[model samples]
Target: MSDAVRKIIHIDMDAFYASVEQRDDPSLRGRPVVVAWRGARSVVCAASYEARKFGVRSAMPAVRAERLCPDAVFVPPDFVRYKAVSRQVREIFLRHTDLVEPLSLDEAYLDATAPKIESPSATATAQAIRAQIREETRLTASAGVAPNKFIAKIASDWNKPDGLFVVKPAQVEAFLTPLPVGKIPGVGKVMQGKLQALGIATVGDLRAHPLEELQARFGSFGAALYRRARGIDERPVQPDQPVQQISAEDTFERDLPLGEFDDAIRRLAEKTWLSTRKTERVGRTVVLKLKTAQFRILTRSHTPETPPASLQEFTEIALALRERVDLPPSTRYRLVGVGLGNFRERDEVVEQAGVFGE
Candidate 1:
C-alpha cells in the first residue's frame, strides 16, 4: 500500500428506479420508462436511457416528461423494493470492505485499499464488484477507481451505464486539467458563473490563479477551490456514520394558510416516523419546519425528557409544535416538514450511566 495514496471506488447504479422497473417487467425492457406517480403535480424519480434520448430527465415534471416522450411508460417508485435491493448491494460491498459510504440507494463510495477479497488491485476489485452486481441482480452498474473519493466520483460518470474508468494518482492532474470548473464538485452553475467572470473556466485556469487572490474573491471556499483544482481531496469513506437528523418534507400544489396545516403536518410526521423506525437510535427532539409562500423558512422544535414512545406520540408532538409558530395567522405556507433530531443510539443510552459511573 502506498503511504500517501488511498484507493477509492465509486459505484453507481444506472437509472436505478427505471432499471428496476425494466428488470421486473419483460414488457418494459428496451423501452423508454419514467418512474414517477401519475399525477399532474408529480415529478419524475428516474428516467431510463431510452427516455433520456427524448430529453426526459429525473425531477422533471411528469407532464413535461410525457410531452418529451409520448410513448414513454410511467411506473411509480417502489421504495420498499428499492430498499431491499439497496441492502443486497450493500451486503456485496461489505464483502469487499467495511469502508463503504452510501450516497443514496443506488450509489456509494468504497475504500478498496484493503479489500476483504484477495484482489490483485483496486481496479480489479472494482471490476469484480461490478460483475457480481450484474450476475446477482441482473442489473448494470458503472464504476470509477481513483486515488481519492472526489476524483473517483467524477471518473465514475465518465463512463455511462455498465462502464468502468480508472484514474491513477499520476494521471489525476492531467485528467482534471481541461475539465470544466463546473465538473468539480461544489462548483454549481452559480459558482461557475462567478469563476467564469474571473477567467477561470477550467481546472487549469483555476490552478493558475493566485491562492491569495482566490481567497480574497471567494472566502473560505476559495481554499477548497485551489485544492480541488490541483486534484486534491482528503475525505475518507466512513461506514456507519452517526445520524444527525431524519426529516420528511413536501411541497403542496397550492399554498395554504397556517390553519390548514394540520393534515399536512400529520402526513409528514407519519413519513418521518416511518423513517426513524428503520434505525435503533431514538430522537428526543421533534421539529416542525415550514416554508412560507414568500420562501421564508421557519422551524419550531421541542425536546422532551423522553423520546416519543410510539408513532402516534411522535405525530402528536409534531402537531403540537406547530402551535409554537409565531407567524401571522394569514401567512400561507408552500411547504411543511416533520423531523427528528438529537438522536442517541439505544445501546449508548443504556451504557451511559455505567460508563460514566453516574
Candidate 2:
C-alpha cells in the first residue's frame, strides 16, 4: 500500500516429510507415501502429491488415510534428518540474503530488496535459490515473489512443487481482485462462512464493504481483512525473532476421561522436550493444555524456582499439573498437549541468578 515498496519472497518445500522419505529411498520415488507413526491414534504428518490424489492429507487420522489409499507406503517421520536438511536449505538462503525468516523446517520468507549475489531482480534470486536446492538436496521448492510479505506468501502457492510465481508492485490490485476471500491468510473455513453469509465471497466483494461496516461486523479482524483484500501488507521480514514457546499436541480418535490421560501426557511431554532440545534456551514454565469432547478448552501451568534440569523433570512437572484441572470428573477430553514457555538463554539465567545473589 505504501508508495515505497519492499521485495519479499516466500519459499515452501514440496510435501517436505513425504518428499524426504521418497528422496532417501529410490523405490518410493514415483509412489504414494504417507509419513506417520504406527498407531490407531496416530495422524499423518505429510502425504506425497501422489497420495493427495487419493484424498490423503497431513493431520488426517492414519486409519482414515489408510482407508483412502490402502496401497500408500506408510513411513515414520525422521525429524533429525529433516532438521539437518532444513539447515542445508537455510544455508542456501543465507548465501542470497541474511533477512531470512524460517517459518518451519520447510518454509521461509526472505527479504531480497538487496541481495548479496548480483542478481538483476528478486525473481532471478528466487530461481537461483530453487535451482540450488534441487542440485544440492535433490528436493524441490516452490517460490513466490511480491512487493510485500502477504502477497508474496499467496504467490508462492500459485506455482507449487519446484515452481516460481511473481507479483509486481503495479500488478497487486489486479492480482488480488478476483481471488477468493479464503485465499487470504487467517481467513479459514469459519471466517469464509461468515463472509459468505454477508454475500462476500471474493476480494472484490470484500472491497465493496465499508471499513466501518467491516469493523462493526468482524471486530479487529475486519480492519486486517480490509487491508489484505487490497494486497496492502506492511509487515517487515524479521530474522531474529526469539522462540516464545515450544509445544506438542494430539487429538484422540475417541474421547478419553481425565483418568486415562496419563500416557497421552507423557507422550506429548516427550515430544515437546524433543523440540526444546533444538533450541539453546531452556524453559522454566511447564504448561498442560486440554480440549474436552464438548469443545471446552483448559490450560494449567507451573513455574518452579528453577527451570527443568532434564526431560524427566519437565515430564514430571507437566504430569503433576494435570491434577490441577478443576473440570467435572466425568468430562471427556478429545485433545491433550504439553508445552514449555518462559524461555531464557543459559547465559541470561546465570546472569540473573548472580544479580539476585542466589
**Stretches of model 2 off by over 4 angstroms after superposition:** 1-4, 246-299, 303-340, 343-358
Q: Under the 3 Å rule for N, CA and C atoms, how many clashes does model 1 have?
A: 0
TM-score of 2: 0.78
Q: Candidate 2's residue-wise lDDT over 199-310, tens digit each?
A: 9999999999999999998889999999898888888889967788999887887899998978778777766765675555768899999999998999999998778887
How far in Å is the alpha carbon of 200 misplaced in model 2? 1.8
Give the clash count for model 2.
0
Error of 2 at 299 (Å): 4.5
Q: On a 0 to 100 scale, what is the lDDT of residue 65 in model 2?
A: 95
Please report how far candidate 2 places residue 343 from its true position, in Å.
4.3
Residue pairs in candidate 1 whose N, alpha carbon or C atoms collide under 3 angstroms: none
lDDT of 1 by residue, 172-192 (tens): 999999999999877876678
> What are the models' TM-scores?
0.74, 0.78
Candidate 2, residue 163: how far the Cα is off, in Å: 0.8
